[model samples]
Structure formats: structure tokens, C-alpha cells
Target: MPTFTALTTLPGQAAAEAFVEALERLEPEPTGVGIFEIEDGSGFWEVGGYFAEAPDAAALDLLAAAFGARTFVVSEVPETDWVAHVKRELAPVTAGRFFVYGSHDAGRVPEGAVALLIEAAMAFGTGHHGTTKGCLQALDRLVAAGVEARIAADIGCGTAVLAMAAARIWGHPVLASDIDPVAVEVAQANAAANGLADKVICLEAAGFDHPRLREAAPFDLIFANILKGPLVELAPDMAATCATGGHVILSGLLNDQAEAVLTAYDAAGFGLCNRVEIGEWTTLTLLKPHG
Candidate 1:
């Protein structure tokens, strides 16, 4: 099917929400939206929405003005070709024992490194980003701590990188979810590619708000590697799903944003177990207070 992908940056506090709402109000609604960070260094968020048909000239003109004193553009994209574009453009990622292959991290890993091979698709976690790697490292350290955990959840599992990692190394039962259909497909494919198909269950979900997420309550470990906003919003849900004394690890946050995230987590009664930094990203581990 054909789709439209538009990426736009709006300055100021509500950029992310504005772009998201505009895409939602479109006549035919986009198939998906790929949020990106432009060079602005502002909190401004970008969205690449996929539609069912080509956007006409009028669409572009309206798009440019939608942000008003901001920036935006719409491009028609065929559904089948977006993955090829992702593989060609996204940077490399390395998390824990996994090394994501891309132009930047290509050939830079040590010979004996434990690597998780991945292609750049619309799916989230690639080991190269600090948030993903931070979570992976935290997970590994937990295992190293010799804590016995039974069930695990990867909310916003993205490319299923972390889900696959947990399942592959720990052999635990895993559930992975993503709001994006493309990400769901990618996560499933990547898990099977890593021979983790049996250990990991991949599905589509919009945060912990999914029916399945509610059904599978009280997970021993939970991972959410999304933006700070969703992280804060989903705090209560993540805590509810965690088994008492169990753990939750979160990422996709900058160091400056860590304090607010910690406050949210704290309010949910999940105290900080540890924190790590990689490049410009932050990951935190938390333990549910025992009753």
C-alpha cells in the first residue's frame, strides 16, 4: 500500500503534541508516524506520517504553515520501500553484548564481543543508541546480580532488541509491544532471526494502555525505552505491572530529564536501584517496594 511520510520540526514546548495532533486530524489518517530529532537541539519533535495516497500540493502548503513560524514537510512514501531507506540512513547501535551494524558502528566492535545483529528499520531499539544500550547493560547487570526473575515485559519494545536480548541470554518468557505495526513486524522478525522466537512473544501495543498489557499483569522486569513524556505518563501503569520486589528499567531520556523521571518513578513507589549514562542518554533501574 502507498503511504505519506512527513517530517516537520516545530519550535517551543508543545511541538511534539502539535505535530501528532495535526497528523491525527488528517482526513484519511496516516498509517504511522516516525518521530525524529532534527538539528534544532530544542525539545521540538518531528513526525514522519505515512498516508494511503500521495499528498497533493495543497497538503504541502498547509503542512508548511501548520507549525506556523516552525518547519514541516510532507512526502509521499510507498509502504514497501521505507525499510530500505531506514537501513540506508540510520546510525549504528551497540547495547551490552549486541552490536548494531550501521555505517558508524560498522567494523568497530571487538572480535570476542557478544553482538546482536540488527538492520535499521522503523522499529526502536538498536544497540547503538545510549538509551537502548543503557537498558541492556542494566538488564545484564541484574542477571549478574543473580536475582531470579520469571516474567519480563518490554513496553515500547521498538525493534525488539532488548526483548530479544533478555530472552536470548536469560531464557525468560518475554512479551514485547510497539504501537507501530512496522515495529511489530520488525520485532518479530528480529527475534526469530536471533533464534529467540520461542522465548519472546511480540505484539502491537500503545504503551501499557493495551488490553494485553493489562492482562499480563505483575511482570518481574519491565523496560520502556521511549520519550520522557510517555515515560512519565506511563509511570503508574509500569509500576502496577511490576511484581513486588521486581525491577523496571527505563531509558530514552537525557541526563537533564532524569530528575523529573526519577520523581515520577518515585511517586509510583519505585525507588532508584541504579543509574547509568552513555553518550547523551540515561537509563535507570528501579525496584518495586515490597509490601
Candidate 2:
């Protein structure tokens, strides 16, 4: 089966969402349509659709124009064994004390490293991306500095990698929440796979909105490795949920956007404790002060 994808970027979320709705109503309706914010501080949203057959280029162009988006670029996606390809391309990643690898490389985990098994099918936060690697490195640095977090949370935790890491180190239960139910399920599965099912509790929630998260307030540590916009929006909530003198590790930011996120967290009562730059991404460790 040939799969075709049509993708375009626009400035506003609203426009991108409306464009997605339009894409769903096309003559040859897309098999799936998705809208995502481009997290590079571009303030742009990308709208993409996949079709079993090639989409109508003329219709896509007209829709793009109507939505103030760039011309839609449609391309055929080659059918390949994506899992096999990812396994071949994604070697194990080492971030400080944590080693993230797929089962194919299970035998390669270092003797002393904390092993996190993440298959490529799980996708997000396999520790291969700079953002996830930065967060893991930041966590390792905190541990090396003798920081102990009894209670922690991983907000927007895609695969619960951070939560698992904390649980592995501290032997304490960590709350892992994601807005997407599918991600929450994946998190739970990953936690089980890592044998941290008892230590990492997975939930479906946006930021701190769920009851479990609310009850787990004043967490000793929090990891919000989400994009800049959500990170900024959740600053005040993070301040309230984090305990005094507790730490928050944040990533999913471009190097240029770190300052803005810092400014937001600073205003929300966090002070920068450490910052690490990996490739084009930046991870920040912030501390809440005790009065």
C-alpha cells in the first residue's frame, strides 16, 4: 500500500487546527490528520495528513492558501519495516548514568549503568533525542550531587523514561502523567517493561490536572520535558506543585528558547540551579526556595 503525506506549516494553532479539519473533509479523505506545534521557538504549527493514495495537490494548495499556511508539500512515503529500520539506526544512548536501548541491544548495557529498555515503537523519549538525553543527564547530575527525591512526578511523560529513572535511583514511586491516553498507556507499558511498574504510576492528565497529581502535590522533583509553550503555561502550576527546596528538570526547548522559559520559571519562584546544552536543545534544573 502506498502512503502519501501532505504537510504544511502555519503561524497560529487555530489556523492549523482548522486546516486539519479541512484536510479531513477532502475528496480523498486522509487516513489520519495531525497538528503539532513546531517546538523550535518558531511559534508555528505543522499540519500533516496521511492518505492511502496521493492527495490532491490542487486541493491542498487551495486549503493552504485559505489557512495562511505555506504550500503543502505532498510526498509518497516508502513502505519499510520502520521498527527494523529504527533498531538499525538507533544505537544505545548513554546519558550520564542511564543507558537507553532497545531490546535488540539489551546485551550491550554497561554493568554499572541504569538500563532503560525503550523500543522504537514506543517512539517518544527513547533517550535518543537530545531533549530526552538532556533530561536524563540532568537527572544523573542531580543524583551525583547527592540529591534525594522521595516523591516525584513526570509531567507530559511520553514513555515515562524520566519517572523510571527516578524510581530506579530512589526506590520510590513516581507519578507519570500524559495528556494523551495512548501515551499514558505506553508509559505504563514501558514502566512494566523496565520492571518499575510498582515504582512508576502512570496516569492520563494534562500537567497537574488529575486527582492523583493533585494529591501528590509539593513533589520533591518534577520533570516537564514538554515544549516551550506548555512549559511556560505550566510554570505557576509547577511552582505550586513543587515542594520548597525541591527541584524541577525541564527540557524540550531549543537553545534559544531556554532564556524565555527561565524567565517564566523565575517569575514563578524558581531559580536556575543548572543548565545543560546538548546539541541544539537545552535542559534546565531549577530549584524552589524555602521561605
Instruction: Provide the overall lDDT of each model, using Cα atoms, as 2-decimal numbers.
Output: 0.76, 0.93
Per residue, candidate 1 scores C-alpha lDDT tens digits across 141-258 of 8888986667888988888888877776677879999898888888888877767888888888788767766787788899899888889999988877899999999998988888
As for candidate 1, its clashing pairs are 4-51, 93-127, 93-128, 94-127, 94-128, 97-114, 98-116, 124-158, 124-159
Which window of 10 residues has the lowest lDDT sum in candidate 2?
34-43
TM-scores of the models, in the given order? 0.72, 0.95
Q: For residues 1-291, what per-residue lDDT tens digits would candidate 2 score against the true structure?
A: 989999999998887888899889997999999999887658899999999998888988888888889998889999998888898899999999999999999899999999999988886789989999999999999999999999999999999999999999999999999999999999999999999999999999988999999998889999999999899999999999999999999999999999999999999999999998989999999999998
What TM-score does candidate 2 get on C-alpha atoms? Answer: 0.95
Give me the overall lDDT of model 2. 0.93
Query: After superposing candidate 1, which stretches have Cα over 4 Å from the reference?
Result: 1-68, 71-114, 120-124
Candidate No. with top TM-score: 2
Model 2: residue 270 alpha-carbon error in angstroms: 0.8
